[model samples]
Target: MRTVLVLTVSLLLFSCSPDTDDERIGISGDSFLIFGHFFGECIGEGCVETFKLTESQLLEDTIDDYSGQQLNFEVLSDALYQQVRDLPDFFPLELLNEKEAVIGCPDCADGGGLFIVYSKNGTQQSWRIDQSKGNVPVYLHDFIDQVNARIALINQ
Candidate 1:
């Protein structure tokens, strides 16, 4: 009888573990991508636009703050999500292994700046890339273009 009871308790404990539940898996478990552009010198509603893209949904920062640190997010409309659904596909794999978090001087000349935060598996990395084509690495050109296009689509 004691053996039976122990088995049942073990089963229950294992079942309740977070690893056993698929629905419990969230942004932390899977990959999440955050991309945005900020202009420190600019004023108005369009100056700061940031987005968090998860496997299941897309969220936009409601605070509109210039900093790329922690920002509040709200789920974007389904229509808006669709417009940038492929944005993640454009991410450069090389960036995942890059050491520098800040590439070149971002927004140094008021030319604006782009930021990306990508988390996958157990690694989370962020980068602040210069808006100018010449300032950033050549590998990031296509990704930057794609980001810009998606941002335009979302704003439209």
Candidate 2:
């Protein structure tokens, strides 16, 4: 009986979910969200940067002269949004766990980056890659490259 009730509730929630075309929580349509921090070992000393991207806008915050400034852009196009939404599926959620134990260079400078994606219905997934360790995941690199390319195109 408990299992049946759980299934019934789950079905009701699914049925009540907004259409993929509806924009909610500032995310456009069924696109995903990206938000996280990229920091060096000295992050505690204002040496870190952060970014967030929804389907309709991109935001960046960086520490400059010990002051933080946030920049917002409305340049995320539909095509680019789709790419960002699909990028997270290639990563395993466990990638977000600290992997310092597997790092090959303990003496190397400690700087790593993490990116998170929140689906339309609020499911979350994230990945963290260490710069002082082995090769960072290629998919993350590709996603960053694509985002940069799109931003460049918009800037021009």
Candidate 3:
């Protein structure tokens, strides 16, 4: 009976551990993906964009089914890709809430944006920030700017 009980408890603990083998990209997997929308002033269910970064290349896509715009794929230059890969690391996972966090005033007339970072160790962090108020976290703001700059490079 004692042996059986100990085994059962061990099995339960292993089962309860967090699962990180899902379809979504992992943070420390040499592949970084950032996807979200611009809220409060977007056309056709918000302007949705997704970016995936890897050591050798960068892939980007923009989709708007409502507007009948098809998926557009853009590959950035090697130099630009390298710059993006080296973006300063910010937001130590410990300082941030593991789950989605929404900060700042509610009625600040801010053009809010949603961002998610899939980090190493199968960790994920997301935030909804008010961009207009300029009260965003320094790391978060810089990361966003870096992404937008990459987008511009592709468009140009």
Candidate 3 stretches with Cα past 4 Å from truth are 1-31, 35-37, 44-46, 62-80, 88-100, 105-114
Write one digit per residue (lDDT tens) for candidate 3, span 1-156: 999999999999987856634412333546455533344455653355555565466666555332223446578677766765643243233325434366453224645454444445555455555454366555455555655565556445
lDDT ranking of the models: 1, 3, 2
Backbone clash total for model 2 is 0
Residues 1-156, model 1: lDDT tens digits: 999999999999987756433322234448888899999899888798999888778899998877776699999888888788777667777777689998878899998889888887867789999888899889889988998888888888
What's the candidate order when arranged by decreasing TM-score?
1, 3, 2
Position 132, candidate 1: lDDT: 87
- Backbone clashes in each candidate structure, one number apiece? 0, 0, 3
TM-score of 2: 0.38
lDDT of 1: 0.83
lDDT scores in order: 0.83, 0.45, 0.51
Give the least accurate 10-residue stretch of model 1, judged by summed lDDT: 19-28
lDDT of 2 at 46: 31
